[model samples]
Target: MQRANAELVRSLGAVRVIDYTKEDFSASGHTYDVIVDTVGTAPFKRSRGSLGRGGRLLLVLATLWQMLLAPWESAVSGKKVVAGPASERVEDLRFLAKLAQEGSLKPVIDRRYTLEQIAEAHRYVETGRKRGSVVVMVSHG
Candidate 1:
């Protein structure tokens, strides 16, 4: 984890944050209830071994092939591989807003850009090294 992002994640009550630059988390022989793949570099096939029983692998940046195979893999295994476009629901948004208001949920912003820099933000996100969310500021002026 990047030093800047690590502080945010820690503040959010993450028990531990592995630094991928210095260590391989998968090779540590530890299993987790939830594994979120943000970079899309983790191996889906081998990830099954990393999940505990009834665990979930949330693929935020899955490839097309990974997305296609997720359902089939879930059907045959106890673990679940979740990947796809997300649907926005009012209830979920409300809950998130509540959390944010309570200071329990703070989004980690890796970079910020104005509306005019949207293309540049897209390119940065595409690089897959962004530690957290990219903010695109919309000026009312």
Candidate 2:
């Protein structure tokens, strides 16, 4: 909601924001170009709703077994719901670095924890509703 209020929501380039907590995103009937799904806690089946007619969904953290049991609807239909590992090539890293260097990049760190405060870091991250990445500061001794 902060992102929406800030008017900087477009920074992520996502046309519409889906708050999975408040509502079921599948009911929106909104077709997404690329749905990068990192969270997979659903069992009621909702792959089709997130994808367009020929859209693609990139599953980031699905297990090998889950990938093997890929959604039947997505395969039968033209829409592709990719499962399993996402290989990060050298080019991807380069692109990330380039983007980070650009003024368009900004790291949203809700909390910064020192290496010695690992427990505190875990606690902060367990809140499960962070806008962006949480930083764990590593001291170079």
Cα lDDT computed for each candidate against the true fold:
0.85, 0.69
Give the winner by lDDT.
Answer: 1
Please identify model 2 stretches exceeding 4 Å from their true place.
1-10, 41-44, 71-75
Per-model TM against the reference: 0.82, 0.74
Cα displacement (angstroms), candidate 2, residue 8, comes to 6.2
Query: Model 1 residue 49 lDDT?
Result: 83
Model 2: number of clashes?
Answer: 0
lDDT of 1 by residue, 30-82 (tens): 88888888768675677888889998999988889888999998888888999
Clash count of each predicted structure: 0, 0
Cα RMSDs of all predictions?
2.3, 3.2
**What lDDT, from 0 to 1, does candidate 2 have?**
0.69
